[model samples]
Target: MAKRIDVADLNIYYGETLAVQDVSMSIEPRSVTALIGPSGCGKSTFLRSLNRMHELIPKARVEGKVMVDGQDLYAPDVDPVAVRSQIGMVFQRPNPFPTMSIYDNVAAGIKLNAKRMRTSELDEIVERSLRQANLWDEVKDRLDKPGTGLSGGQQQRLCIARAIAVRPDVLLMDEPCSALDPISTQKIEDLITELKADYTIVIVTHNMQQAARVSDTTAFFNLRGIGQPGQLVEIGDTATIFSAPANKATEDYISGRFG
Candidate 1:
């Protein structure tokens, strides 16, 4: 089972304007929790806030608490780097460090951020990371090759290898399959199911069928105003949400009445 992420009354703001409002949901561990909604619904924004990435923006602020396991991520003394190390993220696009070799790309997090490990330890970590990402069989012989030499799907998998190299407790993916072809997308979706046995996964996707296919729980968010925050419309098991959503807005959104 995946660990649960408990969010309470979470609100996100950029400068003086709010982007997401009063969102509360528990993300189950060892399973995929997907965030789905129309564009600009703040799914990506909310995903970033979980690891405090929103703090990178000049005036961005996150109110309320996000608890991973049993600890609050935004506690005054909490280190954002520490939070990120525990909660790894993959963007909508594959972002492997193009200049680095596949082996180095997978180990970058450990090499730069992780302070103490012997060379032997790093070798083991890199190998195991690739295995966990399901790319080892294909990339083992090409470890020295540049990350950019791989196909787009392989590049995305390389990114996943990097994220898992650090052994994160949670992995957040923002439309990870959006840039890939159907075969590549299926590869990633299968990887999600496989990875969940060891890591909790949260995904943001516009494809409802994708959500139903890979997610155990789904959360819906919708735009509010020109500048107001996007709000959580509904959240439940994939079966319940698709078969019989309780909220009218959810019904409308799922039924294709409006985005």
Candidate 2:
């Protein structure tokens, strides 16, 4: 099931330096929310914090709350690994396990989490996940092939299959289509539209057109100057953010006037 996310007074820090400051937003369940900003604006940093992936960095930490279904994800005693299981992530590049077969790639997460599923059940899950990712029909006969043997787009969809195989409540994609060709990008966009019916999705994109095309809601992030922490400039329905943002900075950035 999809889950709603509430971020309150969230600040992200690397060592002693703050990267994102006081960002608070509510992400609706079963919807796609796109985060857009120029390079170095902390858009990806903020996305990583949602799943506690940010803390993987040395000396990194987050302040305030990231609540999913009313549970604070960062509260004491909450396990980061468990939090990640509920929220799956895809990266900027398609990174299939180079040595693993396509079938094994999709089954990896499920096997890691469930540890005791029968072979038949694992096969069923791999097929279901590949179908959900829209790649089953294309690769059904090649299940034993190396995942990296596919084209760039197919590899990305394979990664998506892997992500959804675990049945996560939310999916976080950080520039998921950035490395793909135009055709591949479109395929991923269409898949995102379909998946939002079952998973709350948060995507960070530098491509404004892609953001406008795939997202239901949009959040614009910006920084004051060099060394300044990134802040949430404005957020609203996608149409409003693209056409008539209330904040001048948002309008300016969206209009291509400045970053």
Candidate 3:
């Protein structure tokens, strides 16, 4: 099932330095939300915090609440691993496991979470996930081939397949199309549009037009200066953000006036 996320007064830090500061937003289920910002504005850092991925960095931590369907993700008893399983992530670059075959890449998450499963069941899941990622028809003939063997776009879709195989309720994508060619980027944009029907998606993208095209809601993050922590400037419907943003900074950024 898809899930909604509510972040309240969230602050992300790397040891003594705060990276993203006081972000609060509600990400609706079955919809796409895009985070847009200048480089070094903590857009990716904020995205990682959604699934506890940010804390994986040395001395990284968060101070605030990230709630999903009323459960606090940072509660004392909540497991980070389990949190990750429920909220899967696809990174900026296509990072399909080089050593794993296409089928194994998708099956890896499922197998880790389920100790015992019939081969038939595993096969079904891999097929379904690949299909969901729109990569099944292209690679069904070579399931045993290394995942890296695919084209850049196919590899990214395979990564998406791997992320979705475990049936996560929410998906986090960080510049998932930045490394692709224009045609490949279009395919990914199309895939992202389709995926939101089943998964709550939050994407961080430097491309303003991509955000406007793919997201129901858009958020703009910015920093005061080089060493300053990044903060959310404004958030609203994509149309409104593009047409007549309430914040001057958002308007300026959208109009290519400044980063």
Which candidate has the top score in lDDT? 2
lDDT of each: 0.91, 0.96, 0.95
TM-score against native, each model: 0.96, 0.99, 0.99
Model 3 misplaced regions, further than 4 Å = none
Scored by lDDT, model 2 comes in at: 0.96
lDDT of 3 by residue, 109-211 (tens): 9889866889998999999999999999999999999999999999999999999999999999999999999999999999999999999999999998899
lDDT of 1 at 86: 87
* RMSD versus native structure for model 1: 1.3
Tell me how many residue pairs clash in candidate 1: 5
**Pairs of residues clashing in candidate 3:** none
In angstroms, give how far residue 252 of model 3 lies from its true place. 0.7
Candidate 2 weakest ten by summed lDDT: 109-118
